[model samples]
Target: MNKKGESKLTIVITVFAILIILVLSFLFYYYAVKSMSFSRSETASLSGYADNAGRKESAGLRTNVIIFKPSEVLPQQQKEGYCFSTSVADPFRQDAFRCQVENEIFDPCFTTEEQGIVFCQINPLAPEAFLIKLEKPLPKASLLEFTQDNWAWFVKLEDKTYCSPFTGTRPFFSQDQIAYYGCKSNNIEEQIVLIGDLMIDDIWTANKAVLIKEKDNWAIKFLEQIKIDSVWQ
Candidate 1:
């Protein structure tokens, strides 16, 4: 080939290579952003699943409003009521009721049998709170002790299986005459696990639990249990 023609051919090849590199880089960036967006949306939806469940329970009951600081202990007066429902906003009307104490803001509160009034300040340490009603009311001390000891088991069961459990929140269960505890393990991933007869399905974004009394002690059974096929494996 002539020297001029050879030079032109080399220039064209170099430009083509650069164009391919640019296109590849753009594609990579696009997919990375898309993946991140999907992750965030999934997380939000999972969180909303738990919150919405609580709201649904709250709507059915005649609830009262109470307010207290998270830093302080749950007042003895409010201890009698079971927190069947919770919310980030004031479920009551704008002027319905307000917290009497200073720095006591309503982040999440509960509905109880007594006057339906209860309040709690938002605690960063324990962000998630659950409403658990037992089929039979056990002594307050025994219920607290039993739950405290078995909380680790619950955490392991929830996360180790298919569901991804939320962390940092202290486990608290309220005692009432109502049968069955409405406890759930929030799942981040979309998967299913089977524990014995129970099937933990992430389609609901949470796993429900069923407690059975065995003579002297109580046992917790997740409606959905361990993963049959784990991704870690």
Candidate 2:
């Protein structure tokens, strides 16, 4: 009721209010940091291994070691032969393998529009085969025309077209085969998209190529083989 009593009361209230604010702030910061650390650990764990379904295809599955990217955004800044961290949470649960194609040499920043996928085929009698899925898609006409134009260089042995329609758990087929999947619109026939091996040179190194949009035109650039320690099923 006195003046001194009133002043003391006001000071106590102010101090309590400041203490409450400080406690709330500390709690908020603690939780935020904890959530972030957990998220990063989960991401790293996922990146360490391939999908269970993918692992089923082959028995001796080993982790493919390459420079792993923190995430899949801005593939342009990434290096070839590197595996992106975004692999685990993907629909296919596959890692993105970066391989240097011819066009990439000219423009190192050129990257896939979507997440690229990589896998391997198991063959007991033969060497390991790899499959590379490109994020970019080409129309049926464009693919056919490109194949026809480069028939001499693309087709070897018996001039057999090395492409097939893929509609399975995997996003794209083998690197040696042209994977025809996806459609631009409802009419799948008209807008059928093409991916996978865009080109295979019979000459020189027999380099495998993928289609990349350069300026206004689509260019076929060859990719050199990046030998990984293990084959991802």
Backbone clash count for every predicted candidate, in the order shown: 7, 1
Q: Write the per-residue lDDT of candidate 2 for residues 144-202, one digit (tens) a residue.
A: 12212221101111221122223233333245555332222343222223443323332
Spell out the clash pairs found in candidate 2. 81-98
Q: For every model shown, what is its TM-score relative to the native structure?
A: 0.25, 0.25
lDDT of 1: 0.36
Which ranges of candidate 1 are over 4 A from the true structure? 54-233
Where is the poorest 10-residue window by lDDT in model 2? Answer: 151-160
Residue pairs with backbone atoms closer than 3 Å in model 1 (clashes) = 64-116, 66-118, 66-119, 67-119, 135-179, 199-224, 200-224
TM-score of 2: 0.25
Q: lDDT by residue for model 1 over 116-209, one digit each (tens)?
A: 4444423322444322232223222211122111111121232443222232232232242121112242543211222222223331122344
Off by over 4 Å in 2: 51-233
